[model samples]
Target chain A: MTATTTVLISDRPIDPDRLAADFRKQTAGSGAIAAFVGQTRAEAGAVKALALEHYAGFTEDAIAAIVDEAVSRWPLHAVSIAHRIGRMAPGDPIVFVAAAADHRRAAFEAVDFLMDYLKSEAPFWKQEVSDAGSRWIEPTDRDRQDIRRWRSAPHSGEQ
Target chain B: MTTRILFFGQLRETAGRAETAVDLPPSVATRSALIDWLAKDDPALHAALNQDSVRLCIDKKVVLAEATFSAPNEIAFLPPFSGG
Candidate 1:
């Protein structure tokens, strides 16, 4: 059963180890725990930093909706998602998604589902800053495709 | 009816401001109507909203293009999300 759910959006860098440990404590008896840490790409000089912006009231609500949907669909014991807002330097932690469940597959898939939606569904905007200048980053075609799969019924072997 | 409209990210940059409380004229009631009304005065907002990349959230949830929303409170126009 899904026990604790954490959705956080902040300007500070995320501590993946702490987040995982907290979730592990919350889901003590859980069989499997899955964690993912998404960091800013270090593309040498190509991208210097990433600036993130989010709507104040709506960002939290949107993430809550995503978490609720995931909990409903899976038997997750606990889940935590943390994303950074404002500026983050290259290789800084950008996002963290973790799930603990009685089984490995459920924990793994729930994190994936939450992340795909977090990327395409949540209300966040990013700009890449480099020597050339700064420009707003848009979701790529793959991101759109990734989120669409969640709309249809969950089938086996779906990417 | 009054709607507190919000612009985030690139939408804010394009609109040249953060948010506005617009009193919807009887002629303009829905989100689409509001966009059309602003487009007349804000060419950049008009251009930005015209792109399919933009999205609308009434209150806090995303609304489909065809959804009808009564004027109550908040409405946010968003650029493509690139969170994580």
Candidate 2:
């Protein structure tokens, strides 16, 4: 198949290798592949658990939009993204992203681009439960700037 | 025009539901205008909506502050994303 495919889900646990392999097969002719995995750290600071909330229908659509944008902006063969929802412990896997392309540059750049958009643009909210209290998490200015950098950064498909 | 407004994350929990219908004032024409009108109704929504961490999408596409939406549109307001 010459079409790009995507997998977006809000499951409890995500299979990292499987996700990577799926993208690999989809982009079989690709010479390079890139995958980024975000896992829960043991130290959530004062938080015990994090409750991830998302708009059921809108979440998938928004993520799909991001994938489509990446596919258009890069010569990507395939991509996969999966995010976890519900109450998660500190050590749980938070997110997974994999991209494949015919060249290392496109695969690497596309994966980074997708991650930047996903971080600031996706519709997932994190609520931290601590011994003292619980509250909603907000993105720091750092996160915003990280995403902003991508707008001006060079990419494989662009001059 | 009838539009659907969706809330996500803690905002949805705080608002007690995921989606709502926002009847814009006759003069309201853009997304920012709709936000301004809604904020006037609830101070919390006003504050929450103003935070930079919130993202706005019109008809399933992310939109800037000055974007406009017509009838039967779907607009979503969500908190900062933590997706990988």
Output the number of the lDDT-best candidate.
1
What are the clashing pairs of model 2? none
lDDT for residue A106 in candidate 2, whole number 0-100: 80
Candidate 2: C-alpha RMSD to true structure equals 3.5
- Candidate 1 has an fnat equal to 0.84
Over the stretch B1-84, how does candidate 1's per-residue lDDT look in tens digits?
677888888888888888888876766656678689877887777888867667877877788877777765888888888779
DockQ of candidate 2 is: 0.55
Which residue pairs overlap in candidate 1's backbone? none
The global Cα lDDT (0 to 1) of model 1 is 0.84
lDDT tens digits, residue span A1-159, model 1: 446898888888788889888888888899999999999996876999999988887789889988988888888888899999989999899999998888898898899999999888888999899989888988899999998887876733233
Give each candidate's fraction of reference contacts reproduced. Answer: 0.84, 0.73
* lDDT of each residue in B27-58, candidate 2, tens digit only: 77676677788667787877777776577777
